[model samples]
Target: MKFTEEHEWLRPEDDVIVVGITQHAATQLGDIVFVELPEVGTEVTKDDEVVVIESVKAASDILAPLDGEIVEINEALPDNPALVNEDPQGEAWFFKIRPSEPQQMDEYMDEAGYLALIS
Candidate 1:
């Protein structure tokens, strides 16, 4: 999966969605401190405001990757914000959503494309 200029990534599986910050975003965020995720069953639209990530420098809003119903939230972030900084591409992910609009994925940049922009 790639990312958006806003620093969100979308991994759309068969019936689930995985959302996370890109490595580029993690680098920019610095030391993560806290996270605010929407509750399960919340209805969200494409690019909706859904999460709040606090870093040593400031807090950033984590936008929804697609229009979907929030199926699950990563409750783990409240205590281990460092995970976002330590491994943004792995376990540090924000949540899993059942995407309602898969076509929005086309709006995001591919890994290579996003890397170029950040580079």
Candidate 2:
């Protein structure tokens, strides 16, 4: 997985890439209450606001870390938003995309780099 400065994370899964906010972002957001994801067929560019996560503190956009076409979304979010806080990097993932430029994944930060960035 890779992380973006905007706090979004990307994990490769076969031909698609899973995307979500980092654990740090979930912590900063407080308790997540709702999530808004783009439609399955939507096309997005790097840094595009593809998802919106609403927390007790505030609502924040979860940007796309790479250009891609949305292929799927976590249907469980609306009914169970806290999953974002409970497992931001796991079952809480927001969406999946078929990347337009897979190489862009390497341009983002690694786990250690992301940790240093937050620190």
Leading candidate by TM-score: 2
Candidate 1 per-residue C-alpha lDDT over 1-119 given as tens digits, one digit per residue, 9 for 90 to 100: 75788877777667887899988889988899989889999999976889999998998898887888998878888889899988888888788888777777787898888888888
Stretches of candidate 1 above 4 Å error? none
Q: Model 2 Cα displacement at 79 (Å)?
A: 1.5
Query: TM-score, each model?
Result: 0.93, 0.95
Candidate 2 residue 50 C-alpha distance from true site, Å = 0.9
| Worst 10-residue lDDT window, candidate 2 | 57-66
Candidate 1: lDDT of 30? 89
Identify the runs in model 2 with alpha carbons over 4 angstroms from their true place: none
- How close to the true structure is residue 64 of candidate 2, measured as C-alpha lDDT? 81
* Model 1 Cα shift for residue 98 (angstroms): 1.2
Candidate 1, residue 109: Cα displacement in angstroms equals 1.4
Best candidate, lDDT: 2
